[model samples]
Target: MTPFLTGLGASLGLIVAIGAQNAFVLRQGIKREGVLPVVLVCLASDAILIFAGVAGIGALIQSAPALLVVIRWVGAAFLVTYAAFAAKRALRPGILEAATAPRGMTAWTAVLTAAGITWLNPHVYLDTLVLLGSLANAQGSPGKWLFGIGAATGSALWFPLIGFGARGLRGFFARPASWRILDGCVAVLMLGLAVVLAAEA
Candidate 1:
């Protein structure tokens, strides 16, 4: 109970951020396009990253400064490119309607998209392996475990919430205005992330 409670709080703190990957997940979820694969890939990736943080091995991800530098630049590049794509989508909101379902949706595409968004973004390592791991270690022993559990729980809980929650709102979101709003929100988030990446580099 202690570990779970502690984990819940920490996880919520981190998971609340609406990043590019998350935006994609929510978008796909709203469209009900290949939900299973997207959720699986996201949860599996989260489990791996969170478990790495919990085991303390995530601490070693930055052992090589050169490697870290390379990852940072690569991450920044990806974020910028991805952000451009997101911006384009936002500008042309009808694309989301075209992406509707069946015709262009596939399980493998969702997996690849989620995986690319998760693994390709060095921000995942920076946040999960480095930042989250460091924070957990700071707690020491039981507290460390508590924080890790909370972080992991956040991932586990969030994927389903984002997936299904979107479904529940499908009726309201069917509006083009809602699509514009969602795309605008996603665009803003991706652009902000892109700026952060540039600053980090």
Candidate 2:
């Protein structure tokens, strides 16, 4: 119970931050399109990552600096590409305004975008593979799995809550400017992360 609770709190603290994954999920929720699929992808991805961490994959990652470097480059490139897209959207928010935008995103498009945002970000690896893994392993063998399960539970609970919760703010997003602001924030976030990753690489 202690390990589980500790994992839960740590995972929630890390996930509650506004990152590319959370931002993408929030946008999908606001659009009320493919929210379920997006949430499911994030939840499943987190579960896998967390379990991998508990299973000692982090040690493998640590032993291979070259692999981390490769991931860093790829992740930075992906983030830059997404940031450019966000910048373009921010420049023309009217196209996505709730009142004017095409009837939300296609299911496939939304799913793909969500997947890219979740998987292509190196920070996800750092948090889940390194940080969480180290912390879980610290609990010793018996408690590590419990801690990982607790972390997985946190992911399971967070995505649904954030995805559904954003829907409640639909009325506020009726304006085109709201979308612009959102995209602008996303652009900055992505670009900043990209720069940081590139520097590290």
Candidate 3:
């Protein structure tokens, strides 16, 4: 039980950070584009990564800096591309209103984009695979599994809250100004992440 609480706290502490993943999720939720599948992919991927970390795959991943380097370049490219789209949208705020906007982004596209954001980022490995894995193992044998479960539970809870909860702001999002603001923030965030990744790479 103690380990469970620790896992929940630790996982939430990490997961709640503002990042490309969370930003993408919020945008999807606001757009009403494949929200369920997007949320599912995010949570499921987190579950897999967290379990892999707990199962000791973290060591294997850590041993390969080359692999992380490859991921860094790919992730930076993806972020830069997405940031361009966000910036364009911010410039042309007319398409911001989903109710009047043309159909866009298929379910597969949303899922793939969400997956790319989750899997391509090297930081996901550092946080979920390495850091969370270390914390789970620190709980010793019995508590480790419990801790992993608790951490997975945290992801399951948090993604939904952020994903669905953003819908409550749909009224505000209906305003073009709101969309511009959101897209501008997303652009800055994505570009910033891309620059950071490229620098590290």
Candidate 4:
């Protein structure tokens, strides 16, 4: 039970931060477009990663610094591209009203984007595979599995909350200015993350 609680607290602490993934999910939630699929993809991805970590894959990953380097470059490029798109949207903000709102992403596109955002980030690997893996293993035996379950549970709870919970903000986002501010913040965050990734050792 202690291991479970520790896992839950650690998982939430890492994921609750405002990142590209969270921003994307929030946007999809508010727009009421492909929310379920997006949320499921993120949740499933996190669960897989968490379990894989507990399964001892983290040691293999640690041995391959080159793999992380490749991922870092790719992730940085992806983030920069996303940041540019966000900046473009910020330049021409639109209201969230159905009639005037821009065309939303299809379920397939949203799912793919969600997967990319979840899988491409080097930070995700570090957090789930390396850090959480170490933490879970330190708990030993059955406690490790329990910790993994608890971590996965945190992801399960969080994605739905942000994805479905964002609907409440639809009213506020109906204002173009609000959308502009949101997009602007997303752009900055994405760019900042890209810079950090590129500069990281």
TM-score against truth, every candidate: 0.83, 0.94, 0.95, 0.95
The root-mean-square deviation over C-alpha atoms between each candidate and the true structure, in angstroms, is: 2.6, 1.7, 1.5, 2.0
- Find the 10 residues in a row with the least total lDDT in model 4: 92-101
What would the per-residue lDDT of candidate 1 be over residues 1-201, giving only the tens digit for each residue?
Answer: 666676677667776687777788888888888887898888788768876887776768777666666766776666666666656655775675664434546778777878877887777887788878777777778877777778887888888889767888899876767776776777677667767766776
- Between candidates 1 and 4, the one scoring higher on lDDT is 4
RMSD value for candidate 3: 1.5
Report the CA-based lDDT of candidate 1 relative to the real structure: 0.75
lDDT of 2 by residue, 146-189 (tens): 99999999999999999999989888887778888888898999
Question: At residue 131, what lDDT does model 1 achieve?
Answer: 76
lDDT for each residue of candidate 3 in 88-196, tens digit (9 for 90 to 100)? 8888745555423645688899999999999999999999999999999999999999999999999999999988998898999877888888889999999999999
Candidate 4: give the clashing pairs: none
Model 3 TM-score on a 0 to 1 scale? 0.95
- lDDT of each model, Cα atoms only? 0.75, 0.88, 0.90, 0.89
What are the per-residue Cα lDDT tens digits for candidate 4 across 20-132? 99999999998888999999999899999998898888889999999999999999999999888778887853422332255657889989989989899989988999999
The candidate that achieves the highest lDDT relative to the unseen native structure:
3
Report the candidate with higher lDDT, 2 versus 3: 3
lDDT at 182, model 2? 83
Give the higher-lDDT candidate: 1 or 3. Answer: 3
